[model samples]
Target: MKKLLILVLMLAAAFLIYRFAFKKKRAPREKPVPVAVSEQSAGFNQSMNSILSSYYRMTEGFVNWDTAAVGSAATGLETALKQLNVEELKKDTTIYQTALYPLELAKTNTATIAAGRDWTERRHALNDLSDNIRTLLLTIKYDQAPVYWQECPMAFGEGESGDWLSSKAEIINPYLGNKDPKYGKSMLNCGENKMTIDFTKRDSARLK
Candidate 1:
């Protein structure tokens, strides 16, 4: 009888241990959530490319000396912005607002020249705005930022007069006649002057 009792108790304990210990462990798993790209990041690239391409086309028109075409392109760009609206392009749309000032300055300069007025003042103004925009674009991580006058050969020298080019003969080849017209009939009319900005160097280290 005692043997029978002992056997039953041992069986009960074994059954309990097996029930608890032999249960299968759940497999380790990662959360089943979908990874998605932010709309702002994706759309920013698209909008930036579109706007820049349009700006380049307008610049080409200006370089070719087509004032009417430049104005039309600028107008079309502004229209595109209005139609798309900033919210659709980026979460913080104010960055785009910053670009408008220079774009407007460019348009204004082109318009002044087209109106037969002395565009030197407008050009100077546009230059300032362009520089500012370059800085801003760099800050915002825009792909093509303006190259400083130090980097560009024509900005500081090579005006309508040959004095600067003559003086800086050692640094630059004077024999390479000024391909750019300083006192042009109208760069806008011919669409020949396209502004250039440097995109190769970005100082992301300073951004933090």
Candidate 2:
């Protein structure tokens, strides 16, 4: 009985040592590093900023229900779109193809907006134009300005939503606009901010 007790105590001591001391130490888990936004030429950055500015102007026209102003802003957007140094984007084949897809669509939609006179159709075209421009910015990772993506649930018809970009977080919805026959400006602030697009990197091309 004495021998058995001694052996049991020895075994318990060994088990305790193995449990606490023999286990391997684990390495601390590394936190993921955020990928930075890509850099572009000063000209590219300027052109993108100009395009965004023109888009904002167009949004204002929509909000104010000024057809002529909207048309003019659309034209200005086309000019700014042309100023973008597309060749600089061509160096990266993957990015070139992706960026051009939306850029081309922007061209088409802007042209439609500039030429169309139908109010409802023009508003719809602006929705398409807004999407294409947003896609282009995202594809190129444009990080110059603060772009706010907003959506109005009843901009078109009940249950149908429309989206537009703005320079501010405050939702002065371009759709439903400022002129409602029944309730003036009642629905002007009728949208919720979806997200703010700001991928600006720490690099130097940010002179906007």
Candidate 3:
């Protein structure tokens, strides 16, 4: 009976030692944290959206060949551009440097469009403005809303072309610009959609 008791005690002690000494340690779990938007980035987005909104309105005016409306919209775009935080935008050094040229050109062309006497001249300026704005937007990824890049194959003349950004996927030719008053529907859909900028994915990448 004494020897049996000694063996039982030895077995129990061995089991406890193995359980404590040979057990594998568990890895600590990582908890996910919520993403927070910074004030500067939020302001930057607001400014960019405002610029895009004004540009869209200006494009609409061009489509209707309403010079007064176009001028007004251009003025609004100028204001929006002026309000943008350049220092904030400079956070992305690469984007800031690349965007500067286009941004300045957009400003100059918008001013010209606002003051131009001839409709054709204004349209020409508008084309340049559109290109510059498109480049700037693509570089910075201002908003999370999709903008369509549309191209008119016959904008300047046959075989000549121009492109503009639109809020919708549908093509509305600002280059044609209500040129045919007699045929109200003529040249309204003269362009093809070149690309759709889906900003949701793009803006996320920019944030990262």
Q: Judged by TM-score, which candidate is best?
A: 2
Query: Runs in model 3 with CA error above 4 Å?
Result: 1-40, 179-184, 202-208
Candidate 2 lDDT: 0.86
lDDT of 2 at 158: 87
Model 2: per-residue lDDT, tens digit, 27-127?
98875555444578877888898999999999899889899899999999999988788879887998898988888889888898899868788889999
Q: Estimate every model's Cα lDDT from 0 to 1.
A: 0.43, 0.86, 0.82
In candidate 1, stretches whose alpha carbon ends up further than 4 angstroms from where it belongs are 1-40, 80-129, 143-208
Locate the minimum summed-lDDT window of 10 residues in model 1: 161-170
Kindly report which residue stretches of model 2 are placed more than 4 angstroms away from their true locations once superposed.
Answer: 1-38, 203-208
Candidate 3 backbone collisions, by pair: none
Q: For all the candidates, what are their Cα RMSDs to the real structure? A: 12.4, 9.8, 7.0
The global Cα lDDT (0 to 1) of model 3 is 0.82
Tens-digit lDDT track of model 1 for 1-208: 9999999999999999988999787898764454333223555545645555554455444345555765566565454434333444244567666655554554453344334333344234334434543443453455432332212234334553211101111222111222346644322122122233345453444443
Clashes of each: 15, 0, 0
Give the winner by lDDT: 1 or 3.
3
> What is the overall TM-score of model 3 with all chains considered together?
0.74
Residue 168, model 2, lDDT: 91
